[model samples]
Target: MKDSLEVLPGIELSVIHFHSERFTMHHELFSDVLEVNYCHRGRIGWDMRDGSSVFLGAGDLEIHTMDCCADSTITLPLGGYEGITVLFDMEVLEDHVPELLKDAGLNGRALLKKLCPGQTPLSLPASPEISGIFSCLFEVPQKLLPSYYRIKMLELLLYLEQLKPSHVNRLTSYQSELTVLIREIHDFITADLSKRFTIEELSKKYLINTTTLKKIFKAVYEKPIAAYMKEYRIRQAMLLLSQTDDSMADIAGQVGYVNQGKFTQAFKEQTQMLPTEYRKRCRLRKMEKE
Candidate 1:
């Protein structure tokens, strides 16, 4: 397996594979890439800007678009991870099979998340179907090509749609319940990424008991919900810096940091670089790439 960031730069497809020590990469949007991560081994976490970290275990597969500030990624291979990261263009289905997504309402934004958010990543048993489809789409292995992958992706999405909340069975384990709760937390964070939020407020709004919420949330997502929210806010702030001309103060307030100093501190802690420095670096990188 490749031990570095592998970028397959194609007009319509890209694939990356990471295997090694635990490292966090800060992606300041810019790449209109959508990633599907197949965690074959080890524990991985996506520290999204919406707080609650999304945890992917041995068999979990996650898909989401990459835009400015949409990453808080931890690629830790030592912790038992070795797998494939497939990147595909959003238009693939449209160009190849115009009616596939339209007929099934399968575009991620409109359909998938309503069906399966990072809240409950495609679980192990459910992963092969998505992974196979993604692999086929990207043609990474260059064996079966896109045909097989399309078949797999569509089949997986159909299965995913059936796993939604209303259709979920009560016999599903407590961990499953916690996973559902975590999604609710992410929903809250993403909806109001900049507001002041408290545990009590979160519980009241979601109609959950605070203690039970914390217990289950941390148990499933592996980070306190409050901490998740703060980290996510910082990540979003980074994205805003790279993509917008928003001032530091406004940016701080927008991502829920009440004070400039505190925002800077939080930003530094999560990203290892101060906000100004990060912005400068991003600008230089953007200029060089463009």
Candidate 2:
């Protein structure tokens, strides 16, 4: 779901909630525009023009010109994302700066130069103050959304205006080749849930050094291979619990757990409920819906 509001003549705010593997973006209508994105959950990756890739995980911010993302595929490695985007139409914004922002001495062109001095996109972990401002965007009441968004937009810009270059920590960008290899490794490992592969084993099989393999995998997926698989396994187990009548042992084995005891422990750790309890809860929720 995407909700957009033109908070000002040249400033627009959008809330993006995507639950999909990939989204292709076209920038036909975008030029001389600055796009700022904040990731509230999940991970998003962008294939850059120079055969490199950048990623944004939860609590991260990405700022760049729309052209940087032109004709690019945005990959959601975790199959979901929730975020906010603010677009600044530089020409319009420069001509008609909002009175409030003008009084506060905030200029669109200046902000662009400050935040993105180069052609490459700038991505960094959001500061606590910035995160606080964004968190409030998610909870504004419907009736007050228009006014609230405008206020928050100004606040965000003003806050950013005070930041120094040294405070910005650019996120690591990986080569497309390495990212592709890591993705292949992910698919290979997740393809057969009944089997498990160690880091050393995967490294040898994929012909990548173990250090690079682990580093790139964590960068792409935002977790080490083992942690990512454990979460993936639990998510699959959730689907099985809700949709199938498989026995505990069968379900456990299906998701790579050797025994029900181990599966129950992992399930509880991930979901705070045993497999049996989780199944029962699903049934109860389904019955209530019915």
Candidate 3:
């Protein structure tokens, strides 16, 4: 695998840990999840697939997305490199997020990728204020501290909002028009999700080429059009399966699947579980907790 994440035992209790022996350790990908790392000392190099080396040392922080992945290797110097890793499950984040931000991230985690494109794997200290908050959040679940966990999560959100990007200059007419096109495209998909459309139609509608449209969509949404559409369909199917009386065949048709068999297959492929199995599992898990 190109990427992976590992946490050592007692890493949380200890102030520092030796990881040089794991020098070549590569982290695995967990789709839609966020991996946060903090470096305590010494540089660890990442030989990125892009042929660039990111050098991370003590006090450097890094965040990576787990959905789309690539191969990279971590090099711990002979002296040994030390760091802490925090893995946040994507579903947990959605469940815990504030209602206002339950949809799109207030500022979006994608901005974090742009700002901290760590050429290296490291988590240097953030502002002491945030460092304290992050430390609390990282340890909360481990300690079974739910109240403190919620507070820490709120603090993290506040800190993230403080990092919001500032507008550098006035918007040009071209930029304005591009913004309009983005809104139109978003609306078009939201309204006609069950229907299929291509980039060609998008290009013609916006009077721009396919490449530009794709670029803009990715920049704003951090996903390819088709991938997002599939995700949307899967989400809709999951909801219908769990909450409504709709049969699998009816649900499939509602979510743009003309073939009941094909819908079932696609749903399984995306979630790694059949719709019936998932619904049952969801209820079972909930029941077990209660």
Q: Would you estimate the TM-scores of all the predictions?
A: 0.45, 0.92, 0.42
Error of 3 at 281 (Å): 2.4
Evaluate all candidate structures by whole-model CA lDDT and list the values in order.
0.58, 0.85, 0.56
Residue lDDT tens for model 2, 1-290: 99988988888999999999877777663647988889998899988666778889988888888777787778899999999999989889888877877777767677777776765677787578768778877787889888888888878777767867567677898888888888889989999898898999998998999999989998999998999999999999999999999999999999998999999999999998788888998999999999
Point out where model 3 deviates above 4 Å. Answer: 1-176, 285-290
User: Is 2 or 3 the stronger prediction by TM-score?
Assistant: 2
Candidate 2 runs further than 4 Å off: 29-31, 103-107
Q: Is candidate 1 or candidate 3 better by TM-score?
A: 1
Poorest stretch of ten by lDDT in candidate 3 = 5-14
Models ranked on TM-score? 2, 1, 3
Best-performing candidate as measured by lDDT: 2
Q: Measured by TM-score, how close is model 1 to the native structure? A: 0.45
Candidate 1 lDDT, 1-290, residue by residue in tens? 45322222211322335555345567665333455566655555554444434556555666555541265545342234555565544454335433454576555444434533443333233345445544344334555544454455455546544545454322112433455555567666667766776789888888888998887666454467777677768878989999999999989888887788999999999999999999999999999999
